[model samples]
Structure formats: C-alpha cells, structure tokens
Target: MASGLDDVIAAETTLSDVDGANGILVIRGRSLDDLARTARYEDVLALLLGNFLGKETPLIQSELGVARAAVFTHLAAVDATILALTPIEALRALMARLADGEDKAVALQLIAAPAVFTAGLLRLRQGLQPVAPDAGLGHAADMLRMLTGETPNVAQVRALDTYLVTVSDHGLNASTFAARVVASTRAGLTSAVLAALGALKGPLHGGAPGPVLDMLDAIGEGDNAEAWLGAELAGGGRLMGFGHRIYRVRDPRADALKAALAELKLAGQTPGERLALAEATEVAALKLLRLKKPDRRLETNVEFYTALLLEALGLPREAFTCVFAAGRVGGWVAHAREQIDHGRLIRPQSRYIGPAAA
Candidate 1:
C-alpha cells in the first residue's frame, strides 16, 4: 500500500487537473495562467459548478451575496466564547450552524459561507462589529469590505480575485478529498463544506502561508535575506514556502500570485519596501535551497506569494488560512457534487499489523 496514498488515483474528475510533473494546473480545459489573468472569481465558480448549478456569472454572484447575508444572521447566535477560538475554529463553528440541503442554492450557500464567516469571525475577534455583505459588490471586493469596514480599492480587489481564482481548484487536495468523502455519504453540501474546513485547518494542508510571512518578518531587510535564510538552513529548519509535495518544478500558482503582486506594485498599491524584501527573500530562499539540496528541486510554491499578496491586501496573518478557505470553498463544493454523482464512499483498507489482529 502507498503511504499517504502516494501515486494513488482515487477518483476521476473533470473539475481541475494538477499536472505535478509538468508544473501545470488546468481548470475546466483552460490553463491556470489564462484563467488567473483574465477570469474573475465568479466566472471560475460558474466554470467549476457547471450545469449542476447555473453557469451564469452574475446569477452566481447574486446568489453568493444573498447566501452571505443569510449566513450573517447566525453571527448573533454564536457564542462569544467561540469567537475567541482560532479564526478557523470560529469559522467552522459558524459554518456548522448553516442548515444543510442538497440543492444548487445550498451549494451556493456552502460556497459563500467561508468568505462571510471568516470575515465576520475576524472582525468579531478584533472587537469590531461584523459587516454585512453587499449584494451589489463582487465577492472579492465585499470580502475586503467586510474585513476592514471600508471600501476596497480596485487593485486590492483584483489581487484578491486573482488569488481566489488561482487556488479555486487544485486536483484532489486533502481538503477537497475530505469534502468529497463527506459528499459521498450524501450528508449534504453544508456538511461537506464543514468537513473541508476542518481538514484545511491543519498546518500541513492550508496553514503554511502564515509562517511564510513570519519568515519574511524575521528576515527583516532585503540585505539580510541571504544570511538569515542561510542560518535557518544551517539550523535544519525547513523553509516555509520554497517547496511543494506535488510540483517537481516551480509551482504554477506561485507564478500566478507573484504576477498578481507585480500588478499591485505597478498600480502603486503594494508597499514598495515590503515587496522588495519579499522578492529578495524569495530569491535568497530559492538560491539557498538549490545549493543545499542539489539532489532535490525545491522551488517557490503558492504559499510564498500568497502571504505577500494577502499582506499587500491588508489582511491579517491570522486570517490567512480563512481567506484560503474562502478561495477554495468553490472547489470543495464542486468536488463534492462530482463525488456524489460519479464517485463512491472512499473506503480504503489497511493491513492488519497490530499483533496479527489478536
């Protein structure tokens, strides 16, 4: 048996493909580069949902807005104690309060919950009132507004949109697989989404970006990047964002997010000094990784630039994974629907090694 199901192909999917060997990602027959550069998050959502849900972008956006508002009503009922939990925990609690259903509208609600709940939970933790969703605003824009209680600028919105689209779907990742497993039981969309969120809260799955920022902050100045990274490597500490489990080459998502960061810089929005520090740190990390592990191809992955871009967008480091969930919930919902229709219950067998089963 493959440990960690390495090289195991559990199910067939048409939603998204992660060609790790080639360092490419494709969603619904379109290359990730094309989609990230051109498509909005709603457009990608429509693509992933396909006919299971309606394909109209505007309809999805409107429905998501309504879903967000509906989810907000539950905040009043949440225990203030839960708000003191980690952001992901708070989000999971709020999501569990959403009623389950097996319908397109419910799927939309599941997709909408992460964005609303995450923003709400973060605001609540900051001792601020939760901002309601604006049905008129697009998903990315409104998420920013909800988080900060101020209107987001155009560049901020675009950066977030690109992030959401880039991470929307990525093969059968751990969280998406969790979502599919829950879906296969016919537990309903809300349950599947909650399962996905639970899985994503783990550091191995969706928790690396926050550490990436921590690494940068510790490094401090651009001139200090190489020496700081060298010391970290010498101490046998693993670099946070310079490697991936799937991609042998540089992660395609990294390239996409770095390009988004570039756009933010060009628009005069991203902090120049911070951007320079991050870019210098990335270069140093890549160089040191190459020198130290000559046998392995360790390169920058999505988490590297994800931390930078989100930092540029003014999101808190603690809220990083929540935003990741917000982007990935669409993929989770679509995969759940696909598993329900075309996949099985995902029961795997294990060898009896404990005292020969007594």
Candidate 2:
C-alpha cells in the first residue's frame, strides 16, 4: 500500500487540474496565466462558484466588500491586543466573530474574512492600527489599500489580484479537502473555514514559501547560490522551492506569478546580474538533481515564484499562508454552500491497523 494513500485518486471533481508532468495548471477550464493576467478576483470567484450558485450574482462582490469594511468597525477595541496572537489565530478569531447569520451578510463576511483578517493581522503585528477597506475598490486592490493604508497603483493591484486568483482554487488540495470534510458534517461556515485555515498553516501547505526565502538568504546575493544549494542538497536538506506532488513537470502558477512579479516591476531586484545569477543557480540545481537522482523528476514548482511574488508585494514571510487564505475564502464558501446543498455527511472507512483482533 502507498503510505497515506499516496498517488491515490480519491474523488471526482470539477475544481482544478494539476498537470505537474506537463507543467500545466487549469482551473475550472481556464489557464492560471490567463486568469492571473486578466481576470479580477471577483471574476475568478464568479467562475469558480458559477456552477454552485446556478446564476451570476453581481451583488456578491459589492455585498462582500461592504461587509469587509463593516467588520473592521468591531476590531477597534482589541486591535492592539490581537496583534500579539499569530496571524492564523487572529484570522480564526476574526472569522468567528464576523460569522453570524444565514443571509447574504454571512456570505459576505465569509468572502471578506480572509482580506480583513490578513490585513488586520499584519498591521496589528506591526503595532499599527488596522487600515479600513475602501468599498469602492476591487477585492485585491482594497486588500492592498487596507494592508498599506494607501491605494495601490493599477499595476500593483493587478499583480496582487493575479496572485490571489492563481491560488484561489485547486482540485481537492489538502486544505480544500479538509474544508470539504468539515463542511460535509454540516458544520457552520466559520468552523469549516477555521479548520481549513488550520490545515493551511502546516508547512506542507502554507509554510513552504518562507523557507524559499531562507534558502535565498542562505545563498547570499546569488554569487554563491550554486555552491550553497549544492551543499544544502549534499547535506540532506531538500530544496525549499522545487518540485510538486501532483505536477510531474513545472508548476503553471509559478510561471504565472513570475510574470506578474515582472509586470509589476516589484521583483525589487536588478534583473540582469541578479536575475542571471538566480537563473544560473536554478540551472545548476536542476542539473545536479538530474544527475544525482535520474529516477525522480524533480523540478521547480509554485513555491519558488510564490516566495518571490509575495516578497515583491512587501508581505512578510509569516503572512504568506494567510494571504493564501484570503484568496481561497471564496472557493471554501462556495464549496461549503455546495456541500450543504447536497447534505451528505462525510464518513470514510479505514482498515484496522492497531492491535487487530485482540
């Protein structure tokens, strides 16, 4: 048996396609590059939730924006105190507090919780008051506004939106599966969201990007990247930003985010010398890995560019996974609502593994 049911296809879905072998990612029939470059978060949300709702609801966007703005009103008192908690904890509290009813209000709060929670958590951690959301702004744009207390330029907003949309939905990913499992029990939306957030906080999901930065830092200015990476690999430390479980080739989201980072001019990097050095390091790592492990197809994955893209957006590494939650809230809510519509309790059987027949 493959441990943990590894490589097993557990369920059929309409959510996403992860073609690691070909380095392609298709979400709900759309390429990630197409969405990241062109579609707004709202548009992508509409696409993801389209099948669940049975109709397009323009009001969802505005309603969610207003709700996000309104929730910040309550955080005024504990704004400073909450900062002491980790970002994930702060997000959990905010989501629970804002969850209240079955009307559109609940839905809106669910939609807005990620942005509100993430932005507020970051500012609170910085010993700064949380910035308010601008209801007139798009979801991604307003997120930046709340985070920095300044409206992002068109390019900046676009880049952030692309990042949000790129990670919005993937087929039965660990966290999404956890969310569905929780949702299947008919648990409240906030509960399911918190469960999903907890799943995301793990290194296998949310913690990968920070180590990518650490890898970059350890490499020290790209000059010693090759040698440093070689040493790390030789020492039995896995490279932080390469390879994927599902994608046999490259990760499509990696290239998409990389392009967005380039477009925003936010790589905060000198392209020629530094970029060339990074590229050389990447090439060397790949060559060495290939030569060293010919049986396994280890290659670059989404985490590499995810680290660089979020870094360019000025987000601290600690907040990366929370930001992922911000984009994914839509899909989670939609899936929750969808599961509730069907009303099935998730129950899977497992073979007895401990003290069998005792």
Candidate 3:
C-alpha cells in the first residue's frame, strides 16, 4: 500500500491536468494563464460545464444568473442557527437545504450556492439586509455587489474573475477528490458538493488562505517580517502559505493571483503599503523555509496571494474559503458529472494488519 496514496492514479480525467514538476495547470485544453487573464467567471464556468449542459456560452451564462436568483430565495430561510455560524459554516447549513439531483439546474444551483449563501450570511451577521442577485450582472460582479452593497469597479470585478477562473479546476485535489468520491457513489451533485465542502473545511485544504492574512496582519509593514518569520520558524510552526503538496516549484496559481492583485492595484486606489508588507513577508518566509528545509522545495503557493488579492477586492478573510468554493464549484460539478457518467464507485481496499482481521 502507498501511504497517503503518494503517486496514486485512482482515476483518469480529461478535465484539468496538473503538472506538478513544471508547476503548470491546464483546465480542459486551455492553460490556466489563458483562462485567468482573459476569461470571465461565467465564461470559465460555461467552458467547464461544456457538453454536460449542452448549452452555448451565452445560454450557460443566462442559466447561471437564473440559478443565482433561484438560490437567493433561500436567504430568507436563514435563522439564528445559521447566523451563529461563520460564513462558510452558514453556507454549508443553507446548502444542506438544497435537494440532490443530477440535472443541469441542480448542477447550476450547486455552483451558485456558495456565493448566495456566504454573502447573505455575511450581510445578515452585520445587521445588513441580504442583497438580491442581479441577473443582469456577471457572476463575480454580482457576488461583489452582494458582498459590499456597492457597485464594484471594473478592476475589482476583473480581479475576482481572474481568481474564479484560475481556481475553476485542477486535477483531483482533496476537495475535488471528495466530490468525485461522493459522485462515484451516485449521491448526486448537491451531495458531491457538500462532500467537497466538508473536505475543504479542513485546514490543510481550502481553509489556509484566510490564515495567510492573519500572518500578514501580525507581521505588519515589512520591517518586522524577518524577526516575526524567524520566531515562527524557530517555534516549529508551519508557514501558512509558502508550500504546496503538488507543486515542488512555485505554484502557478500564486503567480496568477499575485498578478491579479497587481492589476487591481494599478486600476484602484488601495493601500499599497499592505501589499508591500505582504511581499516582504513572503520573501522572508520563503528564505527562512529554504534555510530550514534545504532538502525540500518550500516555494510560494496560491494561499499567500489569494489572501492579498481577495483583501484588495474588499473581501473579509473569513469569507475567503467560501469565495474559493464559489470558484471551485464549477470544477466540482464537472468532476461529479465525469464520475457519474463515466466512472464507478470509488472504493479502495485496505490491507488487513490489525490483529490479522481477528
């Protein structure tokens, strides 16, 4: 048995190819850079859905808007129980209310759930009324509007679009694997998505990005980056955003999101010093990591820049993973469809070692 399933090939997928050694991620036939730099969130979602929905891009975009509106009705369903949870927790609670199905509408609703529920929960927690979905606006734009109750600038929309596109899919990650596993069991899209969300809630997966901001906040203003980072390393604490499981080199998504922050900064009036401090801290963390683990490649990963980029886009750190789910839902849907349509139940045999199975 391969411990932790290292180099395991459990399934074959034509969805996204992750070339870890080269640090390249290709979704379908397109490079991540091509999609992240040019495509809108709807465009990428449409692309991922592809023949699964058998709808054209414009139609897919239109249906996504309708899906957003459909899921928005559930915002009224939120009660004190939901409000008491964090944004992601509240999102999970609301999503649990959705029915499981394998239809296009079900897939699209799963895609729209995180955005509607997370934003609604955030607003409700702040004593603000939930913003209804605008079918006229794009997914990322509409999401931002719901988040801040203001019209986001072009740059802000573009950055979020880039984020959504960049993360739309990658080869079977932890959450994606969970999604595929549940889907393989014929549990339907909503259940698959819930499974994925459960996996993402773990700290080693989608939960790390929000903590990156905490690290940056504690290290404030570049000057103390070294001492702070040094103390963290000396205490044997794992740096939040420096290393990735798949990419031995720098994560490509890190570059994509870092560039997103740069583009947003160029077009918007943000506090540049915060970006500078984050940059300095990243450099310090990477340098210290190398000194500590000379035999291992501890390079910058997506979480570091994801925090900075989302902060620039006016998102609270607590809502970061939920926003990430808003993007990865497309992938989860695609993978679920693939597993249900082309694959089988995901069950692996374990060697009996404890008391020789009695």
Best by lDDT: 1
Candidate 1, overall lDDT? 0.90
Per-candidate TM equals 0.97, 0.91, 0.97
**RMSD of each predicted structure:** 1.2, 2.5, 1.2
Clashing pairs in 3: none
lDDT for model 2 comes to 0.75
lDDT of 1 at 196: 91
Q: Please identify model 2 stretches exceeding 4 Å from their true place.
A: 51-58, 77-81, 100-104, 266-277
List ranges where model 3 is wrong by over 4 Å: none
Candidate 2 C-alpha error for residue 124, in Å:
2.0
Model 3 misses residue 31 by how many Å?
Answer: 0.8
Report the C-alpha displacement of residue 221, candidate 3, in angstroms: 2.0
**lDDT over C-alpha atoms for residue 313 of model 1:** 86
Query: lDDT of each model, Cα atoms only?
Result: 0.90, 0.75, 0.88
Candidate 1, residues 1-358, lDDT tens digits: the string is: 8788989988899999998889999999999999989989999999999687688999888988888888778888667689768888888888888889779878877788888888888777778899999978999999999989999998889999999999999999999999999999999989999889988999998988999989988999999999999999999999999888899999999999999999999999888899899889988988999899999989899999999999888889888999999999999989988988888888977888767544
Model 1: weakest 10-residue lDDT segment is 349-358
